[model samples]
Target: MCGIFAYLNYNVQKERRYILEVLFNGLRRLEYRGYDSSGICIDSDLSQPSIALDPAENGLADGSCKPLVFRQEGKILSLVRSVYDEADSTNLNLEASFSVHAGIAHTRWATHGVPSPRNSHPQSSGVGNEFLVVHNGIITNYEVLKETLIRHGFNFESDTDTEVIPKLAKFVFDEAKTEKGEQTVTFSQVVLEVMRHLEGAYALIFKSPHYPNELIACKRGSPLLLGVKELSEDANGGTSFHDSKFPTMDGQPKELFFSSDANALIEHTKKVLVIEDDEVVHLKDGSVSILKFDYNKAKNHGGLPRPASVQRALSVLEMEVEQIKKGNYEHFMQKEIHEQPESLTTTMRGRLICGDSSKAKSVLLGGLKDHLKTIRRSRRIVFIGCGTSYNAALAARPFLEELSGVPVTMELASDLLDRQGPIYREDTAVFVSQSGETADTLLALQYALENGALCVGITNTVGSAIARNTHCGVHINAGCEIGVASTKAYTSQIAVMAMMALAIGDDTISSQARREAVIDGLFGLPNKVREVLKLDDEMKDLAKLLMDEQSLLMFGRGYNYATALEGALKVKEVALMHSEGILAGEMKHGPLALVDETLPIIVIATHDACFSKQQSVIQQLHARKGRLIVMCSKGEGPLVCSNGSCRVIEVPQVEDCLQPVVNIVPLQLLSYHLTVLRGYNVDQPRNLAKSVTTQ
Candidate 1:
């Protein structure tokens, strides 16, 4: 939910206007990564270290933005535009006035305060707005900092941890501005100085009225980096870029990259140098250098997470509006949801997936062949992930364990980090992550890789951190899932995991059958998805029928039992209703107490070995007058037959291990439709940033 952009003079004589064009364009590229509102301050000629809360009006070469405290209690970007437009009716380009040197920009995903223009970033402080800054990550002890500042008679504006930076930097700048004026306590110095007094994670960049051309930047427990490159500059030498354009000037983007995902800077450079915690970087014209602010030796940490290859690949500076159009579909979400049936087939696209004895899967075990062999001979496997990704792993766990005949355990990555778990060289660690940038998941994978556990990654983005670091695994060939909630990717991963398990357990099938199943399913998928779409009309009615449900109880048995858990999660995430999932049998032990006409219960009765058990479970709920929605097996109408109160849905049947693969489709649809029914943005849920980069 946060975005960072840095601009430094690239070509010596490029107009500031061109640089601004590119900068604004880059910000637009970053919009998908949801932010409250964007705030920026550029050292253009019209304004020196001027702050634009919401950059409606462009900064100028000589003039700085007015120090107005914009406090609209609405969205970040929205309030920002109103403020920006109000700040100045005309958004005059100030790039030409000052020889632009370097600066940082931000589109904040607010973790603090409401999405108001006042709470926006590019926080400015000092006697006359001498110091300005933009920040990401949470400053945990902000209240304490706020109290201390108040004691010092320091005034504050926004209720954000970021505001402290500009004020604190200004304090230091004033204290050290006169002493050693040049190279001493500049805005960069103030940033480092203020950092000493703060606690928690942050990636920050600052500018000083005293020293306008140079930029001060640092990071700690948060993502930030120097592109170490140059870009087009205004006449005054100011550039709206941070990398050296020429390959040789590359010296590598001094890794302190602020990128949460590599897409931001892949176009600038692939070579990266990591910025360790407490590292201070001063980016100046014709020179890029690092200084030990506290004179403390930086810890040389090993096993630094490797950047993913896809993260390394840069897009063509813009997204295609056409790609998002859903082509022939009525809604983007619906089109994406339908694309899964084919997307899943595509994941198995290159591989041989014939589960039949006639044709076997062409199991391409990345670097895990030896590991898989060991696991085949060893004790067990641990499957882990977070959020929907965790559910994806949960869906694959039973199948992998059953097919491979190896006990597999699935847990959330966040859990493994907080608690010690059973991980051994004898046990293979299979982690599932969509972005591969998940911090906790990365740490969990690190613990496995660092220790001797064989780590396998089933990630969507090809070159993400987890993909690069794991002991080698498959890429869920579902290219670029832009919708943050993850549709096509979720199914593709389940497919890959299912196939991998089957291959490991029984590699006797011929490639032809595996390919046929995948191709047949794939070719039939768009149509199948179309058929599923036909159910949307029915699903919408279900949504309307279930509108009064304050809570839900769901259950499943066997391979898809996890789907019950996922179903409840979906309802909760979108519908904002309280729901719970447990085995139907477990209902008597506890959940049964919650069962009443008021608590609607959903049972995953999809045809599997557990159908009879699911029926018994359903009878118990039905007897108790528990409201129900039965997800029955495709052809088992007799098994699914319920009285007038319960609605029954018969979904397509696949292999037992692949039930989740097929069954989850309907649940995803149910979640999507219900969320729309609840009037929430299904794609970007409020307060949930797309990527959880910070712990």
Candidate 2:
């Protein structure tokens, strides 16, 4: 839920101002991940220190210069203001340059403590503030570790689990020095030792005066990547790295950027290496070396592995800077909502074949082609995800079952873990997530893996953990979704899953015509979405009418049931309103009691297999004098709203299975408008992160 960014340059001089700007901008790019506080730590100009500090207070036994740390309890702008304010008050020269420097910055989403400056990241050790560490995920055993450190006389300043990391590193560093006598104990060694005692997911960057001009970045069950910028003037013009070739350790003008998200690094360098689980990367003297944590070796060395380098190839980030920008839209959520038409098109690109005349319409998902045979033979297919991803799976579930003739089950990743559900080798588990780094989903995936079930990933992120760990899967290719509330990615996920269904059901002769109809619907879906977006102003008008309402209720059945859930989720998530999505059949059971003339209810009456049931629901709501908002097919509003009293949102009709794609657009617009009217942050939302990286 937090964002981690660090900058290091070797043999290349940079002014403190530029370094600060880099760090600040990096954090700004990752604001989408959601954070309540921000902080940064940079090398202090040794010759002219900015902040005066006592040796004991600063944890500098050797009287070394303490790093410049600035932390604020609000946005990144607040942290920037504090830094500039301090510079102006102290007459500090930010233009002062350093030939070799390192800095780490973080935007923290509070977990261990409340959002405050003391709880912000760039958390330091107690003794001398010797080690500064910025972390992304939770530390499950922090209480135990904190108790040990407290017994060792290490006091803490903040109530964060992250505070223990630097303290732990210092403790390990001191013990290593004690054991080695006069022998040098490297930062990597101390970090490796620290990793042994840590339990939980985290992406960490460690900086210390004890090991100057070096930065150690590591990750376990969290996302982290290193961007390499070599200014060596190679024949390739430093644009791309050779395939599978590691950069030389030669002394060259180089810069290294580390971030929990690729969005922060894409602008600086496209050539990056995704740090996998349990891998530690040490950057020093313009050279980068990777070390893998080995349980066997660690057990032998008192739970600290000896240094062993591992080879990893640098992958080119395919995303451009422009993809993350909000463009003419007011918010990322708005931009993404409006981008659905193009995103759906992108999801179907090169995969849907209309079969001009003789080819016979078909769907080809290259990622799933090799695994289709195995999937078809599986006893069952389980779809695992969280939030919007989960809803998307639900929307695609019925069609997948119809096409593949394989029983499809939906699982919320967390629930699956809580149940430790039975997953057999004959089953195929599909994990869906926009970021693919969702902690619960990844943990569930691990559970499925241990059970010998084939795991598949459907994600928008390319180098995410789910994408890397899965046997095979599809990329949603919905572009960068920067909003905490998903829009385009959700639709794209459904489209991809629909295609997966088509690919699996292609062998059935009886369903040939049905498959071709779906393919045609898939081809026409984007246009239908484009047509439905014309209702934006109408939805906005509807939102205005319901802006002051206390609650919302949505009802649907069949495929559009997911639409109802997703629509209500959008309202609750962004509009800051209480909303519920009810199945039409279950409305009378309980949800109907909540309906009244004052309470707003949205019913999906779109033409589908469940149209009659939805129509019956509308009639029941009308009989109860419920405030109704019906999302029906264009020109079919009269059929559902015969009384002419219920507010109607008419959307273009598509194949019954594909109707969710068209049905969701207007609701997304309504939610966006409602959020703006309710004075809530449309993109960030309150207390929510774009990627749920922690349980």
Candidate 3:
């Protein structure tokens, strides 16, 4: 997971300074994708052309310990520890934008390459090595190319999938220079020519000496955006995008910022165009042109998705998707757990913006005010979902019922369709799905609609089937989720339900209160998520304790009951072990028989309405000689049971419904850590893909 950005074309010096600021802030916004080192390159001031143009040229610095080549062994993080710049995340003097017209910057969460300066992107060639490039995603086959290049007299620098781009780019250009007149074709063309030889996924931005006027970018199964803006000279010496680029007008700047996602473009210019797969972007002079790779062997590859668009600046709604996979953390699970706090914050932001400890007696239902009123008059409400979405619905039932003074019932779509008759006539139904296209959930929504229920879908994907089917529903705004066993999406769905509960409570809060509470929470979420990351060591420790255990019994009550189920599902999905989440009350009837010193029981006892009741279950597990691990709110500790045999994890405090937003994070980490500790493949768990499109 990495963030990439580039700035090209600047008539004014002040514009360059502003560009760097906007670009850096944007990368920082997307730091959730894990990376150890970061750096940017532009036309170097010290850059000089090679004196020897022929392959026979010699007398160049090439080796480990030299200024040019990067040598790294061991794990990616360990190598990063040796050379990474602590102050700038390996990208030093980030304010340093070269005098050159085009530049490329990178935040490296290295995958195919070791994390070192040599492996870092914006790699260049020639005497001064002024030309630079930056990249994200995997270039799956590097060893073969590196081997081929080694035989053909390419002096290898770093062992990275990324180094191939710069090396091959220059190689193609250098070889072309001998047969074809250099003036006949530009460097951007050479880059595309080099791209023809590439296989696997990547989204890159670069500048070559041949075409100094343009910033060249390309995408394949990863994300990139070309952001356009107009520049205005600052009154106080700071630069600003010209008036035309701002909200008052549009289409002003040929000046632009490019990135894999919007966060990097948001701080620069809200106006952006998302680059699609295999599409090449030539950005310069305030405009963008999309191109294709005619020379590539697989020019007609069909796996590539439809191209993305240049959209406007997105808020926390999309930030959830942005944060979960590629943040500065080592893995998507890590970033997702760390995102719990913000996930919780975003969930509570819009509806409870003003309420304090007193909680405004009821929810402030606005857009749903009329429908919620009608729903309140109904006898009961049915919540439908499948998989993780179902777990979230299970967690949300009591909160929605209690806060709105309406009855709430939850069920799994697969089960609801096959096992029993669904509720009918005038009842309200909320269908939850991260990808609204979920087949089982969609069928359930159809069933509810046919039964005459007022169907509402709570989903992340905007235009999916469920969203289209629902009369009026809420968007979780979780953005694109790239994991099979849902992490951030689950929490996003929970947060959306919590906000909807608050909104459905009543519609009386002033807009001022809504903005104050929600907007502030949105901004404050990064810090809250930071708090969750601090618990990483603790969760890892817990995972170590339970590593050898064959079975795990997770229990929670109120909003966390579903949280318990989701946590258990994560362990089974990633850890490949037997785990089950049951209601605390259900244990006395069945699971209590399984409790023993050999069985590990995980309890979700966060400080909420059901803490006391759940604690009693923990007490029984301890009395039965069961290994007890509890996740609870920070402080109010003294977690020792009457039997004095228990372990506990404390997370940052949040609202009851919002508790799942933070509470489930530690559980996700617990699974990921356990899997990693056991040497399992965390990214591609057996029989899983990032998306489940097939039946």
lDDT of 3 by residue, 605-637 (tens): 888778889878877777788888878778745
Off by over 4 Å in 1: 6-35, 47-73, 87-105, 125-131, 139-158, 164-181, 184-296, 299-332, 353-359, 446-452, 506-530, 642-645
Model 1 C-alpha lDDT per residue in residues 1-695, reported as the tens digit of each score = 46666666532544645554444444554554655677555443444444442222322223433332333333344544654475466564433543445555567777777777677767777445566777767787778878877786688878778887777765555445335443343444455557767776676776654565566667664555444343454589554554433223233222223344345555555544344456666655444555543423212322111211111212222223444444786555567787775676667665653345664335554545666666676578888898878877887787566556678787788888788676887878888888776667877887887778878888876556677677778888765554556677777777777667755765434434443454345434434544555576777778877766677777887877678877777777666777777877677788788878867777888776888888888788888987788887766756565555677887766656666766767777777787777887676566666566566
RMSD of each: 7.1, 2.7, 11.1
Evaluation by lDDT, superior candidate among 2 and 3: 2
Please, what is the TM-score per model? 0.76, 0.96, 0.54
lDDT assessment of candidate 3: 0.63
Clashes of 3: 27
Give the per-residue lDDT of model 2 (tens digit) for 528-632. Answer: 988998888998899899999888888888998899999999999999999998888999898777777899899998887888888888888889999888989
- Please identify model 2 stretches exceeding 4 Å from their true place: 47-65, 233-245
CA lDDT of 461 in candidate 2? 90
Q: In what order do the candidates fall by lDDT, top score first?
A: 2, 3, 1
Judge candidate 1 against the unseen true structure and give its global Cα lDDT, from 0 to 1.
Answer: 0.63
